[model samples]
Target: MGRLRVASYNVHSCIGIDRRFAPERIAEALLDIDANVVALQELGWHHRGLSNFDQFAYLEKMTGYHVIQGPTKFHARAHYGNAILMREAAHTHQLMDLSWPLHIPRGCILAHTHWKGEPLVVINVHLGLTPWDRRRQLKQLVHEIQSHRNSHVVLMGDFNNWKPASVMFKPLSQLLPECTDQPTFHTRKAHAPLDRIYLSPGLRFDTIKVWHTPITAKASDHLPIVADISF
Candidate 1:
């Protein structure tokens, strides 16, 4: 496969730092990134600020990409979680629950798609806040990656890992081996590498950076991280 561009963003429920709920702004940022596949976190459906409309639908329409939603929290009035937007069709997809009991619900979106006729497995996740919760969630994430050891895997998301040297990520470091430690949180003056991308062996990492722009800086709390990879 040739180079494929992928991006991960925490839309923060489409609420910007200015406290505005604008899905269009998020869509605009995604358009600017212009990635083949984008993994998004904190998408809301039927929420108050969103005017009770499905946020994913609006984004799908605006970005013109096929979407697969993995809702972790569901209620009578609201449903929100992670989702994947792909320029190409996904052969199959599923959701893996990573929720810690009594804590906010979390999940990962596992999507199977192709790039230049090669199978690519994309794992998109939004981890919990506490260290213990992230440790347990990472264990499950590693197991999932191991099961798909045969394919080209790209694991990208808001890992919620603030410490670049944290031992909690040791298992992932050993498995994926290559880690991008660029700051993506707090778009105004980012200092934490909370958002990251990991690749399976054999995939060449060409370039990676945080997609920072005027619109992205105000679109959400975290800026989008883009990466280009090939096999």
Candidate 2:
């Protein structure tokens, strides 16, 4: 493939910064990003208000992309999960349960796709909000990435990391050299870099930026970060 655009977004369960629930808004922002690969977080399955609607299906239809969802846990509805969206059909997909003891379960969804006939591994994650729990999640995250077969590894999603220099990411940094420093949370203010993307050495990024717009600022609590990559 030529230069492929990839994006990471936390849809906040399709709820906007205005505190209104609207999946269409999220879809609009996705369309605006127009990325080949999208890593999404906070997608509910059978949530109370969303029991009648299959969010994963709706998003897939909206984007016209294949989706692989990994729900973290089952609660009153669905606590939510991470999903990877591919521009075309995915070659293979797997879900890795990254839940730790006494913590709200979290998971990662890995999708194997091809670009220019070369294998690309995309891992989507929604890490723990707490520092202690996030540390454990990072340890597990490292192992999951290593287990994948593809060498063109691209990892992204809500890391929930407040401190940009958090030591928890040291292990991940070794493999995916680029540090996720772009702020995406609080769309209106854009104060934190909770959402991020990382790419392996083989994949080079031509341009990367947060897709912050008037519509996107209200579409979700977190903005979408897009990167144009070249192999």
Candidate 3:
């Protein structure tokens, strides 16, 4: 058995609570978490003149981690969406579209990697805001996980789940234990459990917490959730 450190953060396009666009601060917050694998949401990639346009490349260089892009929206000169960074290389990875018509684009990154010779499947996602959208998205997500039942799974991201006890999350809870409960949104005085992590059966988490610190509190609108797991 081996342990793996995982983290999930919605960077709000690198715009902090102070209304500042600083990818450096986000990188610093990430360094503080020091997780082995990180799932990021709302990462912005735009042309020059914009704040930290190439956030993906910048964070990868700053944190010295292998970065994988999972953009849900692509523009003429910009892309926006989820991403994953890992200290170890992923054997395989793919972006799964979770976009619903009439709503903004959304997606998840499904990556196959290993920790200490044990195989792992990590799914990084950013669910939609509306309840109907989230319910459908959850159905699709559950189907995907069920297909990969043999592998140890880790699903983490900004679930956009405002109510911790909402029945909409029942399917996911039944499939994988919700690993964290600490509120991680509205960093100013976080009181919403929008950010979360879930683990498949046979995978056990030792400890999990919302990464709260001076830098993290202002790094983005949502704080990062970190967890240590063994399998």
Cα deviation of 146, candidate 2, in Å? 2.5
> Where in model 2 is the C-alpha error above 4 Å?
45-49, 74-76, 148-150
What is the TM-score of candidate 2? Answer: 0.92
Candidate 3 backbone collisions, by pair: none
Model 1: lDDT equals 0.87
Best by TM-score: 1
lDDT of each: 0.87, 0.81, 0.87
Q: Estimate, for each residue in 1-231, the C-alpha lDDT of model 2 and write its tens digit.
A: 577999999887887777777899888888888898899988864442366466788989888988887877655656467788887878888888878788878888888877888888888988887888888888888887777535688898888887656687878888788656788878878888888888887777789898988788887888898999886
TM-score of each: 0.95, 0.92, 0.94
Ordering by lDDT = 1, 3, 2
User: How many clashing pairs in candidate 1?
Assistant: 0
Global fold similarity of model 1 (TM-score): 0.95
Q: Give per-candidate clash totals.
A: 0, 1, 0
Better of 2 and 3 by lDDT: 3
Tens-digit per-residue lDDT, 1-231, candidate 1: 356999999998999999888888999999988898999998885454564678888899998999999988677778788999998879999999998678988999999987777788999999888888999999999998989887889999998888756888988877787768899988889999999988888886799989988898898999999999887
Candidates 1 and 2 compared by TM-score, better number: 1
